[model samples]
Target: MNTIEIKKISKVFGSKTALNNINMSIKQGELFGLIGADGAGKSTLFDILVTLSAATSGSASVHGFDVEKDAKNIRRIVGYMPGRFSLYQDLTVYENLNFFASIFGGTIEDNYHLIKDIYEHIAPFKERPAGKLSGGMKQKLALCCALVHQPKVLFLDEPTTGVDPVSRKEFWGMLKRLQEKGITILVSTPYMDEAVLCERIALIQEGEIMAIDTPVAIIKSFTHPLYSVKSKKLYQLLKDLRNFKETYSCYAFGQTVHLALKNQDTTAIIIQDYLHGLGHENIEIKSIDAGIEDCFMELMKKTAE
Candidate 1:
C-alpha cells in the first residue's frame, strides 16, 4: 500500500511558486527521499504533506488521510522532524523528550522500545540543556522525540544538514533500523551521497521533480560517456574544458573535473593530448562510472532545455 500520495500539488507564495505541480506516491515501509539543494521547495512540500501548511492547489494524503480535511488524523499518524532544531533550547534533554511525548499523550516508557537505541545515547546527558548539546546529540534527541509517539510515517526534512559526517552516517544507520521495524520514511536531503542511502529518491530542482527511481537505476540511466579529468591548473582546466568544441558537460568533482565529451569519438589520450597542447601540464583523463550527482546534473540540464 502507498503510505503517501500527492497529485499535481503546487504551492505559491505571493509572486513565487514554491512547488510546481508535483506528483509522487510513496509506498509503505519505503525509505523515499526528496533529493535537492535548499530553496528547491523541499520544505514547502514537507509542510504541505505534514498538514502544517495547505497547498495552493491539487491534493496530498498521508496514510489515506487527506492533508486538508483529515489533517488531524494525518498529524496523529506521522512523525515529523523539521530541518531546523525546533525543540525547546532552554529545556533539558529529558524535558524536551517528555514534552513531545506528553503532547501526543505518550510517555517515553510507552514507546521506549521504539527509540531505545537512540535515546540511550542522549540519556547520559538528560540533565543538560538542549542548547548545550553538540549537533549530533541534538539530532538524536530530536529523533527520539519524533519517534516517541511511534507514528507509522516518519518525515525528516534535511535531518543531517549541519551535523558532523560521523553523526550523519550513524543517523542513516538509525533510519535503516527504523525501516526494518516497518516505519515509512520520507526524508529530504541536499547531500547527493545521502540520496544513495534511500531505497528510492525523487530529484527535485527549482520546485520540480527531475526524476524518481532507485539510486542505481538513476545512475544507470546516464547515457553519456563520462570521464574524470584533472590538471595542475584546475580552475583554468575547467574554463578550457567548457570552451572545448567537443565538450558536452564539464563540472568539478572534488579533486577531478568530470568531463562528458560531445561524442565518444575522442579517446582519453587524445583529450589529454588536446589539453597538453593548450599548455595544461600533468593532465589526466580517464573513463569513470556515473553516480547520483552525475545523473542529477544530467537531469537538470535536460529539464532546463
Candidate 2:
C-alpha cells in the first residue's frame, strides 16, 4: 500500500513558494528520502504532510487518509521528528519519553516493546536533562519519543544534520532497525552520500522536485559522459575549461572539476594537447563514475533552464 501520496502539491507563502508543484508516492515499508540543501522546501512539504500546515493547492494522503479531510486520522498513524530537537530542554531523557507517551494516552511500559531497542542505548543517560546531553544523545532521545506512539509512517527531516560523523552512522543504523519493524520512513537530508541509504529519493532545489528514483538508477541516468579535470593551476584550469567549446558543463567537485562533455568527439587527446598549449602540463583529466550528487546538480541545471 502507498503509505504516503502527494499529487501536484504546491505551497506559497504570499509571493514566494516554499513548495511548488510537488508529486511523489511512498509505499509501505519503503525507506523514502527527500534530499536537498536547506531552503529546498523539504521541511515545508513535511509540515504539510504532518498537518502542521496546509497546502495552498494540490492533495496528499497518508495511509489512505486525506491530509486535508482526514488529518486527525493521519496524525494517529504518523510519527514526525522535525529538523530540530523539539523535546523539552529541562526534561530528563526518561521524562521526555514518558511525556510523549502520555500525550498519546500510553505509558512507557506500554510502548517499551516499540522503543526498547533504541532507548536501551540511552537508558544509562535516562536521568540526564535533554538540554545537557550531547547532540547525538539528544537525537536518540527525540527519536525514542517520536516512536513512543508506534506510528506506521515515520518522518525525519535532516535528523542527522549537526551530529558527529560516528553518531550519524549510528543513527542511520538505528533507522535501519526501525525499517525492519515495517514502518514507512520518509527522511530528508542535504547529505548526498546518504541518498544511497534510501530505497528511493526525490532531489529538490528551489522548492521544486528535480528527480525521483533509486540512488543507483539516478546515478545511472547521468548522460553526456563526465570527466574529472584537475591541475596545479586549479583555478585557471576551471576558468579555461568553462570556456572550452566542447565542455557542456563544469563545476568544482572536491579535488576535481566535473566536466559534462558537449559531444563524444572531444577526446582526451584533444583536451590534453589543448591544455598543454595553455602552459598547463601534468593535468589530470579522466572519465569518472558519476554519483548521486553529480546527477542532482545536472538535473538542477536542466530544471533552471
Candidate 3:
C-alpha cells in the first residue's frame, strides 16, 4: 500500500515557485529517498506533507489521511525530524525524549521498545543538556524522541547533514534496523552517495522530480559513453574539454573530469590524444560506469534543454 501519496502538488511564494506540479507515491515499509541539492524545494514539499504548510495547488495524504482535513490523525501516525536540530537546547537528552512522548500521550516506558536501540547510545548522556552533546549524540537523541511514539511512517529531512562520517554510517545502520521493523521511511539528502543506500529515490531539481527509480536502474538508464579524464592542469582541462567538439558533457568529478562523449564509438585513447595535443601532460583517460550523481547530472542537463 502507498503510505504517502501526492498529486500535482505545487507551492508558490509570491513570484517564486517552490514546488511545481509534483507527484509521488511512497510504499509502505519502503526506504525512499528524495535526492536534490539545497533549495530544490525538498523542505517545502516536506512541510506540505507533514501538514506544517499547505500546498498552493493539488493535494497530499499520509496513511490515507488528508493532510488538510485529517492533520491530527496524520500527525499521530507519522514521525517528523526536520532538517534543523529542533529539540529544546536547554533541555536534557532524557527530558526532550520524555517531552515528545508525553505530547503524544505516551511515556518513555510505554514505547521503550520502539526506541531502545537508539536510546541506548544516548542513555549514558541522559543528564547532559541537549546543546552540550556532540553532533552525532544530538542526532541520536532527536531520532529517539521521534520514534518514542511508535510512529508508523518517518520523515527525515537531511538527517545526516552535519554529523561526522562515523556517525553518518551509524545512523544509516539504525535506519536499516528501523526498516526491518516495518517503518516506512522517506529521507531527503543532497549527498549522492547516500542515494544508493535507499531502495528507491526521486531526483528533484528546482522543485521538479527529474527521475524516480532504483539506484541501479537509474545508473543503467544512462546511455552516454562516459570517460574519466585526468591531466596535470585540472582546471584548464575542464575548460578545454567543454570546448571539445566531441564532448557531450564535461564536469569535474573529484580529481578527474567526467566527460560524456557525443559518439559512443569514441575511445579513451582518442580523448587522451586530444588532451595531449592541447599541451596537457600526464593525460589519463578511461571508460567508467555512470553513478547516481552522473545520472542526476544528466537528468538536470536534459531538463535544462
lDDT of each: 0.93, 0.90, 0.93
Question: Which tens-of-lDDT digit does each residue in 1-305 have in candidate 3?
Answer: 58999999999999999899999999999999999999999999999999999999999999999999999999999999999999999999989998999999999999898789998998999999999998899889889988999999999999999777888999999999999999999999999999999999999999999999899999999989999999999999999999888999999999999999998878887787888889999888888999999999999999999
- Residue 135 CA displacement from its true place in model 1, Å: 1.5
Q: lDDT at 169 for candidate 3?
A: 91
Give all TM-scores, in the order shown. 0.97, 0.95, 0.97
User: Per-residue lDDT tens digits of candidate 1, residues 45-88?
Assistant: 99999999999999989999999999999999899999999999
> In model 3, where do residues sit more than 4 Å from their true spots?
none
Q: How accurate is candidate 2 locally (lDDT)?
A: 0.90
Q: How far off is residue 305 in model 1, in Å? A: 2.6
What lDDT is reached at residue 196 by model 1? 95
Which consecutive 10 residues in model 1 have the weakest lDDT in total? 261-270
Off by over 4 Å in 2: none
Error of 3 at 152 (Å): 0.5
**Structure candidate 1, residue pairs in collision:** none
